[model samples]
Target: MGKLVDGIWQQAGYDTDNNEGRFVRWDSSFRDSVETDPDARYPAEPGRYRLYVSLACPWAHRTLIVRALKGLEEAIPVSIVDPYMGEQGWSFSDGRDCIPDPLFGARHLHELYVRAKPDYSGRVTVPVLWDRRHGSIVNNESADLLRMLNRAFDAYANRDLHDLYPAERREQIDAVNARVYDQVNNGVYKAGFASTQAAYDEAVGELFCALDWLETHLKGRDWLVGEQLSEADIRLFTTLIRFDAVYHGHFKCNLRRIKDYARLEAYLERLYAIPQIGSTVNFRHIKQHYYSSHRQINPSGIVPAGPILPFL
Candidate 1:
């Protein structure tokens, strides 16, 4: 929740009040690439890059889903941070399904950020693409990493895997992604982390509006765009999965649950049923992180045990 100021870790955690009651996410600092082109600074190569992620994070979860779906587990290895992010921020403490940093043996995620850029000033985020040889981050933006994983490793991925973002349907996919990103994906955060009632109401209104549209659009369709599962679906899937678990209660986005929309709930189950999709989900980590990390929302730090997921 905390961020580094000129490579120095600051304990001043998530500042929602600074945005005038709006929860605006900080822009990702590292935006390099690992393309397939041979002349690229970070060429797509097996074993050259590793991912540092938190399973609790939806952004990071999307990248993991792409990795698993593409069957690139052998190509790119991952190191997971401890789910419970505290004042020190994301750490490498041993926990269920957590993989500690063996590359630099760093205790904190910010240490790795400082290691890459000595004077980096931004929130040290998860789903970090680390270049082993360059000894720096290739990219930290989850959306960027999602596209990178979708196609950059085609030569190394499983033969049975299909392209999530087909060239012909990219326009449609991007269009769908734009609306979903604003009103659905990041919208819940706006509602949950809002400091003012107006902000909360506005965000929640847009969120449910977007959900209503999706419920109507997906009436006779199998995916978000085109005839196949595209990147649009992956982007929204991460957010939808966490809606009831945390957003509904903790984030104050309780107007209507995902379960309230029959299509969305069924669509969620259909996506979850996909091979390797369920493996990417760690409900314990997901639930614990939100209910515990955001002290501003749930000060008591008491996590609920019910409102159970039907699919699980």
Candidate 2:
């Protein structure tokens, strides 16, 4: 909910006052990559990097799916933060699936940011790629983290998957990902967190427009970009997976549900059927975080029941 400014942690709430009360997400700051080079400062080595994530976050969930699909579970260890983010932001808990920071033994995730750069100033988000060898964060952006894991550690990966960003497919993949991110992925957030009616209406309109486009586009296509699965599909899946359960009612993105879209719903099931993808989703975590953390949206802090998603 806060960001580090000039390498200093500043406690500030979401800035919805700008753009006529619309919530504009800030771009992630940490964007370094860990390539495969023996002499590099942070090489692609097994057990050298750890992922810090929150199960509730769709962005962080992207890395989790990639980690599972690529069979990098053993290669890169992960630590799950508590579902509910407090004023201090994401914190570690003794709950199941939540792992304490093995590298720094820190209680709060902000501590990791401070350790990485004492003067670090940015929104502390997840899935952070922590470099244990260098004792700093390699990257915190989920899009960058997913690509890094897709091929960066191929030497230690169980499967030798080809380039997800294939030469011929890069253009299409990029285009689709951009549309989805703006309309569906981040769109729900804009609508839910908007402080004015105009902002909410604009965002909701764009969201359904994009969803309608996808519903038609996916009529015969199995994947978003290529004939085979790609990162674009993974990006879309995380948001769609949460749409009906959390986004629909909790976030007030109720124009239509993912379940209402035949192609999108089936597409979700197809991805869920993938060997390890389903295991990465935690509905309980996803629900707890959004309902509890965003107190401004739901002041009572009461988590809802009954929207029994088939996936769960």
lDDT of each: 0.90, 0.88
Model 1: lDDT to the true structure:
0.90
Q: lDDT tens string, model 2, 77-139? A: 999999989877899989877888777678889999988888877788898999888889999
Q: Which pairs clash in the backbone of model 1?
A: none
269-300 per-residue lDDT for model 1 (tens digits): 99999877888999889998999888888998
TM for candidate 2 is 0.97
Give the per-residue Cα lDDT of candidate 2 at 257. 93
Residue 296 lDDT in model 2? 87
